[model samples]
Target: MIDVYLFSGFLGSGKTTLLKHMIGQVKAQGLKPAVFMNELGQTNFDSDSVDDGVPLKELLDGCICCSGSEKSEAQIQTLLAEETFDVLMIETTGAAHPVEALDAIFSPLFAERLNFKGIITVADSKRWLSRDELSPQIRSLFLEQIRHADLILANKMDLLTEGEQAKTIFELQSLNPAAQIIQTVHSKVPFKQLEKTTAKKSDDVVKAPVAKLNLDTRVLRFEAGVKRERFEEWLRTLPDTVYRIKGYVPLEGDKYPHAFQYAYGMAQWLPEYMKMQPQIVVIGEGLEGVELP
Candidate 1:
C-alpha cells in the first residue's frame, strides 16, 4: 500500500512552497515521492515549480471535493500503475475542504491499496488573523481547511508581530485542538515532523463543513507569442475580485514558453518546457464575461 499525504489550504496560503521543501526532504530520506496536484482553474502554473524528478498528475478545471464535477479515480488508477513512488503526495486546491478532498482521494476502488497517511494544512498567519477582512465564503472555507488537519503549518510567521503570532496560535488551536500546530516562515516546517504516521480514520465523529464557491473561470488562448511587458502589465493590474491567473504563454523573446502565476496581486513568470498550448485561465468572483487584453 502506498502512503498518501493530503495537503490542503486556502488560496495563496503557500501550499506549493511547503510541498517543494517536503519533496526534497522525502528524497533525502531515500523514499520515492510522487505528486498529484489539483488546481481550481483550467490553466496551470504551479506545476512548473515542481521538481523535474518527481512524477506529477494534475487534476484541473474544478475542486476535487465536488464528487461528479471533479473525479480522480481514473487519475489515481493511472498513477498507481504507471508511477513507482512509494509515497504519493496530493496537493489540493488552496480552497479545498479536507473532508471532501479525503473522500475523493480514497475512492472505494483504490482504498484497499492506499493507506490514509494524514492531512497537512498550511495556514497563512496574516490571513487567519484578519478574518473580518475576507468574504463570508472565504472565511468559512479557510476555517474548514484547518478543522480536520492532522498538522497545521501556520506559515508566513515573518510577517506577524510577536503579539500577532501568539494570537494566530490561539485561533488555530481553538478550531483544531487535535492538530499539531507549528509556526513556520515561508511555509518551512521540518520534514521529520511531517512524516508522523498518525492517521485519522473517522468520517463520522465530526461533521465536515460545506462551502459553495460562486466563482467563474475564463480561458484565453493565444496562437501567437505574447509580449512579456504586456502580459506582466495585465497581471499587475488585475482587478481585486480576481483570485488566480495561471497558464503557459509563448513569450515573444523567450526560447521556451513562460508559465504565468498571479495571486493576491503578485505575478510570477518562469520558463516552461512542457509541450502545451499557450493559454491563460482566470478564476475569480464576478468574473463572467470579463475581457482580458
Candidate 2:
C-alpha cells in the first residue's frame, strides 16, 4: 500500500515549507513522491514551489472539506492512475477544517488502497498566541485543526521568545494531548520523524461540520513595477481582517520580481532570481472593497 500524508494548517502557517522539505527527503530516500495541493484562490501560486518532474495535482478556488471534496477525490484518483509514486502528500487549504478534510479523503472508493500515515499540522507560534483576536468561528476552526493533528509542528519558533515558545507548546499540548509536538523554524523537521507518525484511530470522535469558513480572496495584478516604499505604505493601511497575502510583485529597480508574503500584520519580501508573474493574492474577511497599490 502507498503511504499518504495529510497536511493541515491555518493561513500562513508554513505547511508548504514543510511539504517541500518532505518531498526532498522522500526523493533522497530513493522513493517517488506525489502532491495534491488545495488552494482557496482561483489562481495557484504555491504550486510553483513543487520541484520539477514530481507528480502534482491542484484543486483551486475552494477548500477540500466542502465544495471541493468531490473534486479532490477525482483528482486523487487521476493522480494514482497516472503516477508511479510511492508516497502521496495532500496539502489542504489553510482554512480547511481537519475532520472534514479527512472525511473527504477517506472515501471508500480508494481508502483500502492506501496507508493513511497521519495529519501533520503546522501551527504558527505567533498566531496561536494571538488566536483570541480572531473571529469566534476562525478561532474554533484553528483549535479544531490542532485537536485532530497526529503530529503538531509548532512552526515559526524563531519569531517567538523563549517564554512564548513554551506557552505555545503548552497550549497545543492542552488542546491535543495525544499528538506529538515539535518546535521548528521555517517548519523544518526530520523526515524520519514524520515517517514514524501514525494516525490515531478513533471512530468515536465527532467530526467537524461540513462547511467552509467565510473568507474572501482578491487577486491583484500589477501591470507596472511598483515602488517598494509605496507598496509598504499600502500594506500599512490594511485592516486587521486581512489574514494572509502572498504572491510575486515586480519592484522598481529590480531585475526580477520578489516573492511577498504578509500574515498577521507582518510583511516579508524575498528577492527572486527568475522572472515571475506580478500578481498578489490577498485572503481575508470583507476584502471586496480593499484598496491596493
Q: Please give, for residues 1-293, the per-residue lDDT of candidate 2 as tens digits.
A: 89999999999999988999999999999999999999999988889889999999999998898889999999998898888889999999888987778765687888888899999999988999999998887888888899899999999999999999888899899999999999999998999998999898867456665344688999999898989999999998998889999999999989999999898788889889998998999998889678666
Cα lDDT of all candidates, in order?
A: 0.79, 0.89
The stretch of ten residues in a row with the least summed lDDT in candidate 2 is 204-213
Let me know the TM-score candidate 2 reaches against the reference structure: 0.96
| Clash count, candidate 2 | 0
lDDT for 192 (candidate 1): 82
Q: List the residue pairs that clash in candidate 2.
A: none
The model with the greatest lDDT is 2
Model 1, 69-106: lDDT tens per residue?
23566777788888788888889987677777777666
Q: What is the lDDT of residue 140 in candidate 2?
A: 82
Clashes of each: 1, 0
Could you list the CA RMSD of all candidates, in the order they appear? Answer: 3.0, 1.4
